[model samples]
Target: MPITRRQFLAVAALTVSVREPRAYAADQEQAVFWRAAMPGRNANVLFGYARIDASLVPDIVSDGKRLIDETQRIIAAFPNVEMTAWDLPRRTLPPIWKSISRPVADELRAALAGLPDGVPIEELSGIEVSWLLMGEGQTPPNPYLGDVLARHSRSRGRPVAFLITEKEIREQFWLPRDPIVLNDTIDEPKIAFLLDVRRRVGPIGAHLEQLYRARRGEEIYRFTAEIANQGIPDPSTFIEEEKAGALAFDRLLGLLDSTDAPTAFVVLPIGILTGETGILPRLRARGCTVTPIV
Candidate 1:
């Protein structure tokens, strides 16, 4: 029998529990690193967006392959160019604000008044509530500063937009873990394997190789059983899972600012690319030619 996408996510989540190795001298040197001078005139950054759905794992995998194909084509057209691909890792919501602050709880209650009455608002933090409302295309109060992003996503001949959210800042945001970059020159086979694993196991498998490299053991028995018995979470829960994606976008922007590579191609979840989070605007302000992938 084949493993399902949900199973893959459950397994991936389990890997997070493994005790991370303590810092070592060799580990410091082993950190993955790559940087280059910014691109000169005529260089454009490419942004790719795809909706994430466990039931539509095949479609998600196809979209990723398309993004990679387009990126390779771009690289081939430009000489003396160095490209970096960043995989936005998944994030978990911290304890709800009720556990820490009353003011945050009051704000959440007001912002999420539109949610279904049966929904458990108390279980969610203010941020998670905001993200859920946004996921549904509803604008939350004080949504990210700035106008909608990727306004020229289509005009630039980027990928087709499969999903669109009404307010961008309502998009989820979280802090990112350490950064890692995979190079095609030395890790071609590994790259192929990563893609194949994602095809079989879904997006969660996308991080499998990286987790293994960090010495996170592949202990899937418990996770398999847990996913087998699990049912789909409510909409609020689903949106909570997406909050980390926002942080991933922020992390990518930081990388763009630090590197000299004139152009960058980021493959991210659709919501993060299109939301009002000001990512597109911020990138453009930095003088980047932004083209979004469908």
Candidate 2:
């Protein structure tokens, strides 16, 4: 059953300042990953999605000798390390200073315009107003899956490794800056820019949480291709997903080739491992037998 937002925050130790996104089903061992423990199978991996947590599935952190997560985003959102969390707000003031951009101002205007007047939006900035429309300062129910698993692994004395660095991840998520508009005067991702300053991106985000909780991997790929198909909806679409999965898979391959200890879990985005160009197919192509572990 979908837990309430308060329960979700307590269980996941995370927050998203948005309307309640449905939690994953109550399967204790619910997780997504292909195990290639066939002949010459040197590694054990658990491919994971970023947002859903143990509140939704208790055994999220698969038994791993050592963990290899995809990026530092997982570590950043870790329960022990959330204070350094990113995603700050915008600048500027009223009808005079004009600190925020036109897009922000326009979206804020339209969003407030949708509500009854005398609403007292003077104190709210663009992102704050957007959050007000979306919900509040609490995050959606889906917390960082990779971090949850990582934290669990650490607690169990299991070692952890990162497939990429924070710089690399920042680079991967980096977006070209708009010359005119200055959101914190940095190059904000289109997805982030539109989201942080967007009018109505909450519904699509909520729907995504629904799809993810259902564990319909291939359906997720197709769903993006058909419905909320955009860079904003899912920054890692077909090509990017393939490239990322393949790159991570290759790194795992090399790591396994070098190490004797088996991989405890190989955390990655579900979208990166489901479609034709995803990790599982590539693993199969390499002659390794793939089996669904969790």
lDDT against the true structure, per candidate, is: 0.31, 0.42
Q: Clashing residue pairs in candidate 2, if any?
A: 15-139, 16-138, 16-139, 17-138, 17-139, 46-266, 64-264, 92-99
What residue runs in model 1 are displaced by over 4 Å at the alpha carbon? Answer: 1-63, 70-250, 257-265
Strongest candidate by TM-score: 2
- Tens-digit lDDT string for candidate 2 (208-234): 455455655655555444323222222
lDDT of 1 by residue, 190-222 (tens): 223323333445443233333222322222222
> Where does the lowest 10-residue lDDT sum fall in candidate 2?
11-20
Predicted candidate 2, C-alpha RMSD? 10.5
